[model samples]
Target: MKHGRNLPKLGRKAAHRDAMLSNMAASLILHHRIVTTKQKARALAPFVDRLIQTAKNGKKSLSARRLVARQLYSPEAVEKLFSDTAPKMSDREGGYVRIYRLGRRVGDGAETAVVTIGMATIKVDKKEKKEAKKHKGERPAGYDRTKDEEIFLEKAAAKSKTAEESAEEAKAS
Candidate 1:
């Protein structure tokens, strides 16, 4: 009985499949759209959708970012997913990704598809847009960057020092 065991193997080992999916998901997050074999695109759509769903959970708390980071394997991609991509779909309940068939590949004639974030076509509601704006970490309108830079630099230095200390402790242990 092959019940409930439906993740496509994609002709690769578990680690290889996971790694490929992680990379593809990161690329999708960074680029917003990607082209690949239909099989791979189908496999990737749900994977990316789940990540987007997780990203829709309010503002990017440290814990939420860390959870998505574990699956994305790219810090920048995870950051974009939470800060940018996720907010666009915050109002939508599910189906965060869309796949379009693009005829076939040139070499092996494999079926190809374009996977994209679903928010590109839909008009966002005003209320949702306002809510999304609050989570984006944008400065207040007409804010003065010159005055803020000092505070920003101080916070950045402190964060880096803590990170370095943690790394050093791990090494010593």
Candidate 2:
């Protein structure tokens, strides 16, 4: 009996859903990628693709620009859409967005995913090219694990221990 149902409600009313989708579309244009729930990403993919297609289809027309601008309210997003994203994607016909599932959320267990423009790229190390190709779903090859907070925590702990020992020696003296 589940027929003729097309739209995903996303637990929001019509106006709210429209606003949220519009903002999400703008954010995706600005950042090139965004983390969101799988369902939301699915819904947003086609919406954003159509916007990109519109921009691509009519890059020079003022009316086309105005039409896309009406959908995405942000000025920067519209500018990027017209200038960078649209031209970058003009070679392709469609399918502008890609969604990758990233397991479930911790608190609610909802399925999460990342949606990115298909052309987004990151610098990768030449040595890890094979490994990076094997695990394309993860980050780019140049990711720095040394910058992680665990290293900072270890350094802080060592400093704190040394400080405690120096304080103990001072107290004894």
Candidate 3:
């Protein structure tokens, strides 16, 4: 009898668990990342993946939106799921989410984890690293170090020249 009932109860009744999972899934959809207990994160990852899969399948279909809406219950989250999140994951088959364990909590000692959409990290080349070191301050807003190194350096040099000119003008004044 207990053979197939292997899902974690999470110390909650069926309705409570469903509601919690729905809310958590909606939050994850809207925010793209969340922090929670390890067990909960594990439980949520599959749920979110399924939702993303549904969104990917449906795309702009009404039935798919309705199906996802039933589980998420948030119109904004549903829109984000269908419009933004799903399209980004269109090429991927599965495993849309990732979980990172964060060791134990300080107060209760419960293990924590970060659940997030699988975002790709940009690799920094040796030349870029050397260029980044040459300019030793925070990059300007909208400047992507990985993609626009030369543009960033050009802007930095322009800014430095402007700053020096302003200083010289001030001294002359």
Instruction: Highest TM-score: give the candidate number.
Output: 2
Query: TM-score of every model?
Result: 0.66, 0.70, 0.68
Candidate 3 global TM-score: 0.68
**How would you encode candidate 1's per-residue C-alpha lDDT over 95-169 as one tens digit per residue?**
888888999888999999888888664357999998888768976778998878999999999999999999999
lDDT of 3 by residue, 1-173 (tens): 45685667899998898889999999988888888999999888888999999999988899999999999889999998888999999888999988888899999999999888875322489998998898778777787666677878889999999999999999999
**By TM-score: ranked, best first:** 2, 3, 1
Candidate 1, residue 69: Cα displacement in angstroms equals 0.6
- Quantify how close model 2 is to the true structure by its C-alpha RMSD in Å: 10.4
Candidate 1, after superposition: displacement of residue 136 in Å?
Answer: 44
Instruction: Show the lowest summed lDDT stretch of 10 residues, model 1.
Output: 115-124
Cα lDDT listed for each candidate:
0.87, 0.90, 0.88
Off by over 4 Å in 2: 1-5, 121-124, 130-173
RMSD to the hidden true structure, all candidates: 20.3, 10.4, 13.9
Which order, best to worst by lDDT?
2, 3, 1
Q: Which residue pairs come into collision in candidate 1?
A: none
